[model samples]
Target chain A: MEWQNELTRLVKTSYPIVQAPMLGVTTPAMVAAISNAGGLGSLPVGGLSPDQTRSLILQTKALTTKPFAVNLFAHQNSPVNTAQADQMLQFLKKLCAQHQINYPKPDLNSIIFHSYEEQIDILLEENIPVVSFTFGILNKEVIHAFKEKGTVLIGTATYLAEATLLEQNGIDCITAQGMEAGGHRGTFLDSKTLPLIGSFSLIPLVAENCQVPVLAAGGIYNGKTIKAAFTLGAKGVQLGSAFISSNESLAIESYKKSIHDAAETDSVLTKTFSGRWARGIQNKFMMEVENSGLAIPDYPIQNALTTPLRVLAQKQNNKDFTTLWAGQSASKAESKPAGEIFQKLIKETESLP
Target chain B: MEWQNELTRLVKTSYPIVQAPMLGVTTPAMVAAISNAGGLGSLPVGGLSPDQTRSLILQTKALTTKPFAVNLFAHQNSPVNTAQADQMLQFLKKLCAQHQINYPKPDLNSIIFHSYEEQIDILLEENIPVVSFTFGILNKEVIHAFKEKGTVLIGTATYLAEATLLEQNGIDCITAQGMEAGGHRGTFLDSKTLPLIGSFSLIPLVAENCQVPVLAAGGIYNGKTIKAAFTLGAKGVQLGSAFISSNESLAIESYKKSIHDAAETDSVLTKTFSGRWARGIQNKFMMEVENSGLAIPDYPIQNALTTPLRVLAQKQNNKDFTTLWAGQSASKAESKPAGEIFQKLIKETESLP
Candidate 1:
């Protein structure tokens, strides 16, 4: 049951589950141990600068030599204009005055992170095991480049039509995401469609119709859903929320503990956190931000403007100001060390009674 | 491809699509042509007498000796006490008067046309080729009795858990219904937990998980969907809405025309018309029933009480008083001779572009 079909041959994992590479939560060590324990591990690089991405990859490599994946946000790059940035800075300055924090000058918006080209170059330079992209399609040139470099390519899609689009665009595998998954929104594939498919509905539809293997993600924290995904014909499962507090993760300790203390219904999707849509436990700043109805900045700008506040809130152990992004299954998150957590996941898979 | 499925073996037809047995619309001739064309034809028994069920079986056989399925409502008998029936009738009396129909007494509640047990007995006695139960489950004994007599026992479930429930009991096949299907709302598996697994979500999930044969039913009116269903691993597909307006069907011409003018968003699920959950085109009667705060009786009784109004509405071609049960794919419906429709459906599976 553990070693069935092409997925086992590709990943060399015994179970049909992969600990998903969450941008800020999943660590290189976590990915390595999970892969070593018979499941694929992933490291996503959306929140880091290009040099930072290079450093994280180097650091993750030092921790483990096992095969692992790295995820990239393929959304286009653009920064907020100085005028909008200044207005946003003034608004934040007022909030800082109210909160009694010295308003820092906003040079944070200048931080341009790894473009896919830059990231792809680093991945090829380091010979990364697998490369996955989300939030948009990879064009022909990129696909050809990655194929030449012997990368296993995967695409994230929230609907069958989008999964079909990804397949048409030459993705080796498709991640059929549900509405329940946390982190940055993956609605880029079908920004125009009215109906969004949930995980329970999307996985089977994509799996049944697509010729390639489908990886199920979103709200899958345990072995029960792992089994359910396999039963739904998913060749593999990608987990997002289960690795938060693992020893390999770099998120603030307070952030990790908040995940452990979360409730099933605590998570809500709001652009307030990042300007782009994301799911996190409802926090004070988020609630206030949500109701402010101020024309917020788009993806990268919104993410940048909120960074100072999030960092300050984190430094102060203030869950209210921090983003605290979590999947719907956050409450079930465990605080175990990375290696043991993977082993426990496998153990739980074995112990389904 | 027409020869590539269980539906071909069951109905001995070239097309796997079945014209759903709409309670007030389907007729013996419609079922006969579909079965003759090598697709399952369903004769609805929810509105029939026990004698009608027995005679319809013989009538269908006289028209065509081909195999066919009979659909029945299997709600757990909610005992109808005299007082409850009186209260419901008195409540409906004012509404019936508003419709300009004769206010009949409450004899309709006591008149159970066909108990599930008695209907099961009739099918066994007649040795019908197939039987599908909806609205809820029948006892295991009924399933065994039908199967023992060589009847294929199909159960309809709105969610996977209920499908699992049917599988745990003794069902030969299961229908994964989405919110898009028409007729009486058989969503009683659990009031709160309707998975509403639309065809896009349900077909592959059911096909992958259930060991029994899986049938894709709901909102499917085209060959592309039938072909898609087979690709998703469904052994066969059962269509209910496509045949509603076949040349052989008993639906009033006005009803058939109404179906043609429908848009994709035209049909919605409402507890109108029959006082049971059903998906249909919005009508004056439906709007009235919805506006009235009076509670409705469960199946059969509510269905029976409204029978007079519906019949009178049909006689007068009055749209307001009749329940037009239609699935969401009503826009795609084409009125043809049943055999021609079946031929096109089978041809679609055989020849894909």
Candidate 2:
């Protein structure tokens, strides 16, 4: 608890562990479970409609009166290129052909992703205590609005520069998301270039330089790692893939199994799945798409494009085609109740000699 | 001091910090200075003749009475591929044409870098207390010989799998080199694939899983980072670029200046200079070579091929041509005596509440 004073006071949590907001994986039950266990659980509100976001947040609230965070994506939406979109669809057609599935053409109507402003409005309306963001920095007005509501604003940073920017922008906390994290990289600068610094190195640099409290994320799965983070000057630690296999997680059985069966070196970073770098257990879909070297559309577009394949693959329990988002240390994950996992983390950290 | 007991007892150092053996950077003075300051200094004897290696070790011993380590590359020497070598030479020719320098043909007889067997014999004769290796694991017979001689064996691993392999092979210590580290990656597994995992993630995984004691390396610059490594369960820390700017280091004034001028995101991982993945400051040579997409020869060959240009560039103080090896956190390095830097690290760590 020596490392918990500042962060614990800010988040009002017994433990400084923050369950990462993993899209399509973290459920309301998982969020509530982690919060109820005295750790902060974050509901992934990114890419969800305003109404959907509100309902999910409310559901999480109903499950636990304890404080929790709502996560959102603040990425700038790039205009869809028709030509690139067509090429991407054609590439997917070839991928579908290999799997003997039909490739769906781009739905022009579905091009627009969820509006961040609308999500903010919903968060404000519900008076959410904490709000974490990824992809990019929120505008000043948005940040001001959140600050007005006394929201504990957390931002994700892949490099020290991003952490400095977050501190300058009045962010309450910064999550130093190392390159080994699951799902999309939270890098906001020079997005094409891979910074790819590991947590061991990144956390200390971010913690020492950035004035704001640091939340170490990526490849953190157990109590030892949590203790390591606190030692590295992180006020808190955010875990993603480690919680994916928990009973409270909404991940498909196959997804959970994929995480469980993974080896330490199984995770690979690829842009094929979401047109943004993300670490995951390599599968046939990732391999083929990477091998083909086809340029895919940007995020939300690429994310939507691969939805069918992922869904169908999940239904058929075909891990080869599904995106198995996981951190490099997914091998350490245990299939247990999230509350039990939280307790185990606490016990392990406390037991460190 | 709390984290130093196990490592200090094993290595006979007052502190758990180990100065990394950086070829072309670490000098006898630097090694002795670190050892004199109670941190174990390592001599980079990799790819050196037995006579040259012995001279350097003797020089270091003459300067300092403290125990030190000698490092060697244990990579398997593959036969030169004439056709591939020719293609690589041609590609370099094009690069040289741009610089208006006369391209030198391969001295085929100079292909064999050094003999590790002979190097080991010299270490045994010198009664070196510590010997660390990189690139690949040594055979059991070699490891057994070192162990019999009371030489504490440390091996580098980029992944947990490599650490397991090192432990199974009876290594006494494991230096978990994260991807953010400068210099050539120590990965011996699938050499072609870049396992660019950060230190935050890599160290904890290696420390928790590996039975042998772990030494965390890469992107560690100061006392805070040293403390962070211990938190990650490292018995010690091996720092390379952190000492690059130290007065005792052999790095040129320009090279030291480059390290001092770099930002957190300035360093990049490239296989251009050595055809082996190493993190360094982005230079004209690296940028052009990467852009060319030309297949380069393996390490030692490509490293030798660029030596002349680098030498001339260094003499001219042109960072554009020289290989400015550095870590992602190179910006933290300060120009000072190695002993002062070491003391600063201890002071910073001690001051931490």
Candidate 3:
């Protein structure tokens, strides 16, 4: 069975599997390891500054000469609303005080925020081979610029409409992110409600509608799931939770342990963490914040406000405070090197009838 | 390409496809058509009296000699609270008045409420070959009786735990119902939140854990989805929304039209219809009732309160006041005879690699 399809040919990988570029979880070594092991590894630079993004890409390049993708947060930053920010700050302060942790004052003004536009020049300068983005689409000019550089562009979509829009905007590939996906949903289409289409539905719907090759993401952790995605018309599969426990992942030990010990029902979608819906294991913070019934500010604002607490929690090894983002099949994650996991995925998929 | 798996053999069907027993939608003709077309057809008697159940079974048996399953609502009726019921009644009266429809006075005492236990005698007397249930598990005595009669007992499960429990209770097969499934969720385990696991995650997890043959339900519509379910480790596939528009379905013309016009994003999960979560197309009644924020009575009570409105709406061809139960891929539904739909499903599955 030849696995060399349009998606694999476009991405220049031996297999159609792509490691999901999960923010805070994906490391440079992990990206390089997956890329070197015959699958596409993605470096997540969603909230990173241009310098940080450049350094990570350089580190990955040093480890492997294989093609990889650089992912960006294409979401437009919402204007800071002082009243809402103050309310959230007070709420977080109360939560921190109750937990006996010092609440660090967030210097919102001093926070260095780099837009995807600002990082594009750096990506071009570094001669990155592939680029992927979520939360929104890039402008026509930026897409034109990437196309000129001969870089393969992939966009994330939570719905068929979003996938169609990505294709119209000249995206080379579409990653159909299902509701079972762990990180922030890439729902950019304006609708009265959130689209929670699962992979079983979303993959075939998007693949049948869009001419571009579609990669299925969310709840995919093993060879069987990979084959399921392909059977549903996906050109490839993107996996995040499966690699959260890999040796090269940047997730803390407690987070990795939670993924290992979790069940299928353990992960849930909650907006309290980043004000954008993300799937993670339910914890005290998510429960209390949701139960409080307070209006959560939009992302970047909520993300910035909670950064100090998450950083402190990470340092203290407190799983409750930090976001333990994982897909529905977190329990299938294995504690192995990224290359070994990649190799196993290839073997498992090949062994399937 | 032979589809003679354990599930197919157990159900006595040529194809491992089961037409979902959608309450208020499935008809005797539809059941018989599917059964005669080499797939398992199910007669839904979830809320019907023994006389009604017997008539439907006899009607189906008259149309086809092939074996079919009879489905029951095994849910225990909650203690009726008059205060809550009265509140719901007042709310429904107001809604009816607003719609300029006569609100029929519900005879609470005269309501023909029959338990699954009572219906068991009729099933046994009729020598029903297959029995499937949802909402809760039947008692040990009921299982023993069914097993003694050589009945193939199938159970519905939304979570892996429920599937495991069903397997432990001597269930012959388990239907892994994903969150994308329409109608009431069969969540029996007590939990703080609902389990919304998708088919991609739920089917594989349930299939791997349970010893019984697993059937994947939810968001499955065509041959490609059937293959996807099989690849995900399910031995068979159960689909409801796909058959809603068939010629033999009991769904009203307006309801079928709404399903035909729906997009993937058009359907949503709402609890306002029956005080239990069910997916359907978003309509005026669901939105208005949900916006009212009035406390909804438990099932059977709430189901009773909304019955008049739903029935009236059906008569007037008004889609706004009725439950338009459908899965996420409702748009994929085709208008055809049930036999044609069944044959098409088999043809599609066999055509896939």
Q: Each model's DockQ?
A: 0.05, 0.58, 0.81
Clashing pairs in 1: B12-B38, B13-B38, B20-B240, B185-B277
Where model 1 places Cα greater than 4 Å from the true spot, the runs are A12-14, A78-105, A108-113, A191-195, A251-258, A261-263, A350-353, B1-353
What is the lDDT for B230 in model 3? 90
lDDT of 3 by residue, B145-247 (tens): 9999999999999998898889989999999999888778888887657989999999999988988899999989988899889988999999899899999
Residue B286 of model 2, lDDT score: 87
Instruction: Indicate the docking level reached by candidate 3.
Output: high
Of candidate 2 chain B, the 10-residue stretch with the lowest lDDT total is: B191-200
Candidate 1 Cα lDDT to native = 0.71
Q: Pick the candidate with the highest TM-score.
A: 3
Best by the lDDT measure: 3
Q: Which ten residues in a row have the lowest lDDT in candidate 1 chain A?
A: A189-198
In candidate 3 chain B, where is summed lDDT lowest over 10 consecutive residues?
B105-114
- Candidate RMSDs in order: 10.3, 2.3, 1.1
Local accuracy by lDDT, each model: 0.71, 0.84, 0.90
Clash totals in order: 4, 5, 0
Predicted candidate 3 versus true structure: per-residue lDDT over A1-353, tens digit per residue: 57999999999999899999998889999999999988999999997888888899899899999999999989888888878878888999999999998979797677665789989999999999999999999988899999999999999999888999999989999999988888788898897699899888999999999999999999898889998899899999999998999999888999999988988788988888888988899888899888888889898788888899999998998999999998888888899998999888888988998
Q: Report how far off residue B343 is in candidate 3 (Å).
A: 0.5
Clashing pairs in 2: A198-B198, A198-B199, A199-B200, A200-B199, A200-B200
Tell me the tens digit of each residue's lDDT in model 1 across A50-168: 78788878877887777777888888766666676666667777776788766565585456645676677778889886788787877788889888987888888876667888898
